[model samples]
Target: MEPLELVPGRYIGEGQPCFVIAEIGQNHQGDMELAKTLRQAKECGADCVKLQMSSLPHKFNKQALSRPYNSEHAWGETYGDHKKHLEFSRDQLHELQEYATQHDIPLTASAMDIPSLYVLHELNVPFIKVGSGDIHNLPLLRTAAACSKPLVVSTGMSDIAWVSQVYEELTIQDPPTPLVFLQCTSAYPSPPEQTHLRVLDTYAQMFPHAHIGYSGHELGIHVTIAAVARGARVVERHLTLNRTWKGSDHSCSLEPHDLRELIKAIRSVEAALGSPLKAFQPSEEACFMKLGKTLVAARPIRAGQMLEEDDLVAKVAEPRGIPAQRLGSLVGGYLNRDVEQDESIMEADVL
Candidate 1:
């Protein structure tokens, strides 16, 4: 499959470094301090910092808005009010976009409604991020695909059929949209058991044309690292300043320190996952020198004696002679010279 370039110069594929996303979704907690968070994400080695963009009225109906938000994480009495506190105005988003451009920090956002997606598309975001909740929103998917920007879609609380529909819709575009499907579980602090990381493999097989990725809500950074090892070219993990912060996503988010370590760990694993073509590596030469075995003289033998199995033993030798694996060929051969006990059986010593 041809590698897709998600950003201008960076490519996403099997050979490319894992694209680490620091999803600062609503964790800014209506602070309007996106610049600070963006800077922190850069310091944490994030390839990109993702924000959440939404037109609340367009996304939620009156009935849904009227629902009481009673959790301790709630900033307002009702769900709508709570979301309003986190929602950024168009001007605010533009300001954040400008800041990201100035600082050279790559930034993108999740679009929850058509209007929001249009706004982001107008801004020429690196890509449009479709949150998991919108997996079945065919209209939104079509609108996003038309935007012509590559997409990073999270698939959580969704079945294979739902995913297939999304894939089919995107693939039929005039020029097929470049896509990355992030395997995710909807739980806020998704447990390891529910992560279903193996689904990444499923996505790879189902959508060979699209890049496969992971968006983890699981606790700790290990699972995120594991995702990269399992062929996820993109990894999205929530990012927050503190886990104790008053937000539903804080507990699942990685703080600056954790984000830094997660990036480090992913890169380390990428380096360690080297080429699939198996052959001798320079790094393994020392091990081969010390532990490689060769057929050796099991006991003292006089010149002109025929070599036999009883006279050979495999052992480590300074100068490698006939390898232990080829010992059968020498069994019927006659020796031309005497050999000391414990000496490697050389090819030149046999007829």
Candidate 2:
């Protein structure tokens, strides 16, 4: 598939560097100052920093919003209040976007509802995110596709049938929306058993035109790095200053140090992934000279004697000779000259 230009000069797809998104989400806890600090994701090597945007009234029904939310992490007594507390004002989001620019990184947000989707469009974010909760909302999906910006959609709390339907709806347009499908499991701090990273392969197979990625809520960077190694062209992980902070996402979010390590490990893995072709590498030349084995004469034989398998052995011969693998071909061939016991076998030594 051709690369999707996510931001100016930044692409996501085959041969491009994995696009890493540090999702700040609601971990800012409604603190504007903390939000700015979280934007430092660029310093930690993220290609983009993302937040979650929602207009509570447009996003949730009254009954759902009114439900009491009294968990230890609650910022308010009701679910609505808690979400409102974390929701950044439109003006605040604009400020953060400008801040991200000064830091030289792209800033984006997941539109939790249609209203917020339009808001992000107005902000001209390089791309728009569709969090898993909105994946089943076909109207929002259509609206996001209509916006024509790159869309990064998380597939969580969803089945393949629904995901396939959504993929069709979004891509049926004339030009087809520039899209990325991220395999995700909604569980916070998702257990390894449920992570189902192989879903990345499924998405790639199911939607060859769309870029495939992984959005991880697991405890460490290992799974995230593994996702990259598994051919994920994009990866998203939540970011937090402290995992012990009073928020649900905080528990699963990567700290600054952890984010740095994750990026470092990802680049290393990408480098190691290299080309698929297998051949002798220049880096191994020294080791090959030091320890590579060759076929050697196991016993002395006079000229005109037929070579025998029993007469050949592999060893680190003083002078590199016909490779050990050629020993089989040498069998039954008459020797052109006398050879000393244990001498390396050369092509010229056989007729």
Candidate 3:
């Protein structure tokens, strides 16, 4: 979410610095072992790390659990067990908050249901994030907005109107409103053709008061970095230690190498963007010496002879001479010295 008033506000959407979120999501794979291992995700260049808050029963049907939505990395045989394994208790979340705070990383998450939202509220999380699945959950959206916490809303599968409605609803609060919309395409490793990056611009125009962002599902670093270059202020991408880790998000998540590369690229893009000034730079000052023209003697000319175009030629290696552009005014001036052929001519050598 790009709303900066939520404590870490300076890093959200446009003109403000980009806030990079490393989404750990369910890659914790229901093992607290993995979550603790990721306390340093921030050191890897993320401003925040995100988790998913969900209840096992609410998230999966009983039948689905028995059948077990089989994924290679899941710990349990069924979907319920898998979610149960992934679920972190309130105490666990509190520990996570402490770890994040201690490390100077913002720990945030997406609320998938009312109970999850209640848990987050109880935890007094810094903000609320709505995922692609909940974009149309008006009641959930209202509940989230009512909390008056900063909101990060993702638009994965919705049309413009659907997103517009969400924006309008969130704004029932006030101006300089505290919400940001992430342009997302809801697919596991979403396709490039489907990534309508142009929506970031449209969203910015439609809700100029809100921060516009990009939540990436692609399998690499290029798209997220490109989004920053195009003016997106918030970038949230799935992240994992290993892409091969089995989970819904693993296939699309950035491994440490890729995530690091993206962070470097985004920062380089910002440095390269610089201020829009068109003036010459320090490194460019050298070019002028090689390319600029300076007046030079075309051939030997006696001191009494008035200078003539044929007597001088413009050439590089200026040697502190008058520039060639001023040669016209010096045409009839007297020669102060007897100049040799092909010698660089100085203004002091003429009247």
Candidate of highest lDDT: 2
Taking all chains together, the TM-score of candidate 2 against the true structure is 0.95
Q: Write the per-residue lDDT of candidate 3 for residues 137-249, one digit (tens) a residue.
A: 98888898887788899998899998888888888665534887899999998998899899988998898667888999987788888899888888999878777776778
Lowest lDDT 10-residue stretch of candidate 1: 31-40
TM-scores for all candidates? 0.94, 0.95, 0.83
lDDT of candidate 1 over 100-181, digit per residue (tens): 7777778889999999999998888899999999998989999998888899999998999989988998997656799999
Estimate the TM-score for candidate 1: 0.94
Each candidate's clash count: 0, 0, 4
State which candidate, 1 or 2, has the greater TM-score. Answer: 2
Off by over 4 Å in 1: 318-320, 347-350
Clash pairs (backbone) in predicted model 1: none
- Candidate 2 residue-wise lDDT, 121-179, digit = tens: 99999999999998999999999999989999999999999999999998887788999
lDDT of each: 0.88, 0.92, 0.81
